[model samples]
Target: MTYTRSEFPDTFLFGLSASDPGDEALTEGFDSFRFPVHWQQVLPRGRGEPDSGGLDHYKHLIDTVLRRGLRPCAILDSSTLPDAIADLGGWRNRDSANWFAHFAETVIEHIGDRLFSAGPAARSWTVGKSDHLGTDLRAHARSLHHHLLATGHAIRAMRSYGMTNLGVEFQLDEPEANTALHAYFHGEYTKDYLAKFSPNLPKNWQRDFDSIDEPIDWCALNYAHFKDLDGSLPWSSLHREDTGETPLYVVADLGSVENTENLLGDIRSDLAQGAPIKGLFAQAQEGECLGLLQTALSGGKQPAPWVAPTKALHGHWNMVADVGGTNTRLGVVTNGHLDELHKFPTGSLEDFQAALRRVRDAVGTDPQAVVAAGAGPLRDGVIQLTNASLTLSRDTLASSTGAQRTFVINDFTAAAWSVADIKAKDVAVLQGSGSPPPGTRLVVGPGTGLGVGALLYSEGHYHTVSGEGGHMGLSPRHRDEVDVFDAARRIAPECFFADSLAIEAEMFLSGTGLPILYQAVCMAGGQSDTPTLSAKDILQAAQSGADEFAVKTARMFTEHLGAITGDLAVALIPVGGVFLLGGVADKNRWLFGQEFLDAFNAGGRFDDIRGGLNLYVSEMDEFGIVGANNFCKNALAR
Candidate 1:
């Protein structure tokens, strides 16, 4: 059967084995590439400073792979150690493990962030049986123990830099006729070998092994022959039971079409039987093998949709728009700053297109790029507004504005991106002090509707994770809250009551939900004479301390907002801080006083973690516009 990319899991990586630099074309149809970075070649002495020229070459190779949109997986080869280290006993020496770890650290310091994955050595452990290492069993065992130790040490070193995707390659040879040798190589190597040789290992060896959390993220298996593939499945299951890792099969030495077909057929069968394979790596010296693999994977499908350009367009204007439920804001970014800001009411999609045309006419020239962030879920480069009848897509934006590149993202995703460029003067701290730890940042806003998104910092870039977090179910915390929620359910059963008696966080926390909350409060408090009020009137009366129900509603709103934010913060652990956005939070800053703090810090056993998190209210009026500009500058410039 012909296999397509869609047949495999989306996260399953297909890749090629690259041999040299400037082999970008070899990676055209692959998601990743495996290349060797020799230890002796990089560090001639294997102990002191590295060769500057060697480091530069590898750096360029990694950059080229990334430019081709392929993950670069480095193989730190130690099969041929430097002559200086070879004379000093090589893998037989305990100190060699530490030296290899230092070498790994040096490489990571140069390009760790860009690396998608790495392995300690490339099929080096299997070379122990060769006569070059002599015919002594004890000596071979010592070398094997040190190799595993070096692998563990290398993994530990990478973990220190927050680079965790790591693995080890093993060559699976055919089962020997001699059962003793067969059992020793296939089964004992991973199971009983470590425990049996523990007493003979170097001092403090267990420490290094314990440092590894999951042993390896993946185990790469290279079979000696096509028929040997059947042994891999059971072997993988056994290994996973022992080490908690799945296997990535490596298809090598494909000399004929028959061999390639047989290999792929076996892989497909294995996958159908639920073999728990992680991915596939096809070893290729020419384009023939990769070409066939790509053809089968494509299954006559068309190419993917147009993606936004990664590289920035220098000396060109970029247009950005914040398409909201009530208003639409458009602006042009020139020389890395937002300018020519324009605002108008949002109507139909056609109206939005007309507004884009007007903006283009006023600018006197078409922008090189356009990005619009609307309040909704973004799917296939299109956003359907949650609280508005309008829909925005990259196609419409490009057609209307005559732009070369276009993007559509969720509104809160733009807010999350804006956190990367937010200034101190534009925000007021609600909780915690000093700068937050560098990691993920959460952005929550209450406007026409509640919106939530998170920004994760990794590989020198900020990635946005947007979703309908605002729709999460909210439960009553106390007797007073129970009465209010019951009243809310009776007032708006469709909005508050679902399969359960839980209400969505946005039902009582957003602009549209504010008046609902006010009426529910009035009804629950037996205020039969209370007049109907808009969200504005309720906030005004609460601020003036004139209406008892209005004041109670405002307090309940802020307190619930604080409680929900704290719960999300605890779940996400966004060490980069939680930023509160939108006009509601900015204008009603006084409401986020003592009661808000008390509700937010009510995490019982997790009080310390919740209370220590940095919380702020953003006062920037043009946050979405600034965020779109930041997206153009940062994300596209990558």
Candidate 2:
């Protein structure tokens, strides 16, 4: 006689051990169990091309479990992949990202009505070692990027097939899950640090899944032990050595408990001071652990403190765009990491939509959001490009890129946010630097024109402050500067003249301004043989030391820039940090040595104010795109 689901109680027993179906699980008195549906078993080739012989094997296994009154929860992949895809560089390859999606779609198509919940992947963590996902990266940031790429792809693909119940299972303290920044985000990094840290998750693997907005039917913690050296156990032991300053404690006991009293106490301690704990799950054997938890939960008198996890932006790809007058730079941002940077010439593209289409095609998926930083002020959610024949608006941007959320901001505003998540290699310190002192950080640059903004750090949040500060008065200090300012007032084209004898700071500092300074220096020095040079030519000549007039022109520019920087330091009082950005600072970085420092620190009575400020030159070209991405992330999280 064949057994069936009706023969046993609704809560019958079963557990899956390796590939042996549910026979041992049934013997162990477990009601429900999960099993792996290896991708290699279904489509040995990794693509949609199916191997019929391999497909039938998994179908028979599922049918066998059902016949024995066992509930089958299918985990689509145990990080398994076909050899073909693994050979092609696995998850690191953009093409392989879709492999998980294809495999998920195929699995759901075959077992659409059978699964209790369709789980596409398990333990979706990345590190430097070669793992089941076949991705290898020494950097913690890169691993996370590809990890999200694969997860997002599979999630979108599975949902497209109409499978309602989907979830992701994760292990919190897995050894490989704790890489440099990976460990830092998980409330663990250096044990010898001076701060008594807490169990707060600055970053979590769950966010990648949550961002997709796919409902999690269940979360299975692979191993329930929390007493290991790296585990979140004994709650009190999980902290850095205390600094002289008192640190806010955030640790909690996340271990499996036996009785109801201890369990309630453990949870209440975590919620003692409004620290958020979304949900608690027990992963012990069914009798003592499950019964006590069920009884305690059922008999609760007052409502339990229920705090949900951090809500994330929707699970679509996020695109960041930095739009200049001549060209636009676009890249896809996932989990705060940017990749696949591509350039689009605005001259060729008919409109913003044309540029967006090229970006969308390059990404090969619809973006959830697009954060754009354009070289114009954003007014009423729209911006008219200063150098191009395009107007960017949120409404049109969303329609063009198929992004659910769209944000357009001033280019300088975007530059301010880029500093928040800057990499070490991206920054080149010019003067007075260790770590940034805590306060407001300033970003001012000269490209087509002078751009100015500040990043305010208050209450653990970043606020971008920007205005028409670029048009501040240019006060001449030295004789050369006085001559240059006077010459700029006279020879300045009619377009640059604001009023009688009023020379704005940008007239001697910006890309266009650099040439004006060179011509003024030629006039002041009476060098009649000096050829008329463009800003680019002057910069090149100065860098090569080929033209003395060009060298003096560059020097006069820096001296004025340094003095203006000192003035801004006095007004804004950004003791935290100061960033010099754009092509002007980066191209002639050689000029920022002693002469520039001397001029910057020449703030007379307030010389200490400018001298103490940490200064950095941003070498990144697409810093605006980075800022826009962060702006979108923060805005959405809010």
Candidate 3:
């Protein structure tokens, strides 16, 4: 697994935002690994000893990585760990030598033997310390020197354990990289001007200026990378680009460097021109980071000083995997942020792979890091190897008239595949994140049809059973007009409730349901002559409390929606919140807000049945995207 000079043309060294060596490399097939060890974990709270947390577990994890052929680097994180926060009274201050040295000694004494390098993933001061009051600018950046020395010393000490490399990861980790607040960092020109106005400026400003002390000596960060996780953050962030008119993403452009792919080439050029080290470290979001890095590495292009991790997975700190209906899409969410997207549409085998190719090419991505593209639902029924079986399937279809044309998938199983974890916080739904019972969660979206998913919590994990539970027959509330029953009968004439007897809750409660209710109202109220409008139009009028018949329809739709949600809740009682998603949930907030809650919570004697359950709206249309990214990141992590 050793990276040869030619393997990385510029001796690129890739690693993680977090993770120790063996755990890092072995997981994602990286030659090297990096895991940040919180200093708080290394040093105890209130000036005590650090918690070992059974170093053997870590040792074993690393050993696992090493056995899998990967190099691992350990990072000593002093700032963000909870212990550090707790010790600092909810603030990351105390950049003291004793703390640094003590933590360094701890690492050297612990698993130093297995480490490829001891890293200090440097922090770019937090907003609190800079804006408020803590340390002056001089003291802020100077704080790094103490920690840097400690890091260097630890590397020296850990090397005694048969170690070979030591590295520094100087980060401008501020997602607000390009904010105007950073204008002070430019130099004395702004410094004098600012001092003249404020006299005693905020400690936060001073703290921020601390890191700007010296150009991070290139010689020290011999193997470094600039992590710009989001490009649109800069290009379209704050509308600061040359085009001042375009809407801006809150995460401004200066905070990140995603606008230019050549940004990497520039960093390499700087390193070669005696700028610094020879690697580039960029952020690939939670799941896509290492995958994209690997993609870059595996490509025919000559690699730079950027070092790739031997292993990669969605960091446990914040990871989510969302499987799509029909197994066609997957999304990865990290700490609730949807970051990566992978999708495979159910199509002709050949056409599917071709579409996948189109998707990859459109993203300007390479296919080397792709493990496999799978098909089928989680219930274990249908699976078509759309990627692998494409050519043969196409030929078969062309030659044999009996050949199946389109791939059929069990959308429920696909939904379950994404929700297969032992536990989770929020299940994707129409009403964002809802709080349910202490087990798995269930959401039933009844659109044109029903969409059923069960969130199962087991052995400290959350699993969702996405199934076609929508087609179930609806109960006739009050001898529905035989007319409606007759129409339903025409659509589905079989089974106990079909053909005039069965009414699906979906047609009565989902995105397509409201209109039916409205249509029924119009016909019953003698306004059947009114122009036909889509479900969306009815809700729009309902939202404004207009269109009398629309109001009645909205109320009825809300009632049915609540009834179905109640049924699902009673069945799952999900401890994690129930999230309502899709077109109906997003737009019909008025209905859910007013009458739906009233209906669901209005149990004559069983109010307690629905009392504890929480409801939410899934705002991001990219739930599937996040699910896809989560799947990729988690699969890679595993």
Best-performing candidate as measured by TM-score:
2
Residue 172 Cα positional deviation in candidate 1, in Å, after optimal superposition? 58
Global lDDT of each candidate: 0.72, 0.62, 0.45
Error of 2 at 406 (Å): 0.7
**Tens digit of per-residue lDDT, candidate 3, span 399-453:** 2221112122233333333333313254333333343335565554444345666
| Candidates 1 and 2, the one with greater TM-score | 2
Over 4 Å off, model 2: 1-315, 348-351, 361-365, 423-425, 493-500, 527-530, 543-545
| Residue pairs with backbone overlap in model 2 | 13-30, 14-25, 14-26, 14-30, 15-25, 211-315, 212-315
Better of 1 and 3 by lDDT: 1
Best first by lDDT, ranked = 1, 2, 3
TM-score of candidate 2 relative to the true fold: 0.53
What RMSD value applies to candidate 2? 20.4
> TM-score of the candidate numbered 3?
0.40
RMSD each, Å? 17.6, 20.4, 24.5
Please give the lDDT score at residue 404 for candidate 1: 53
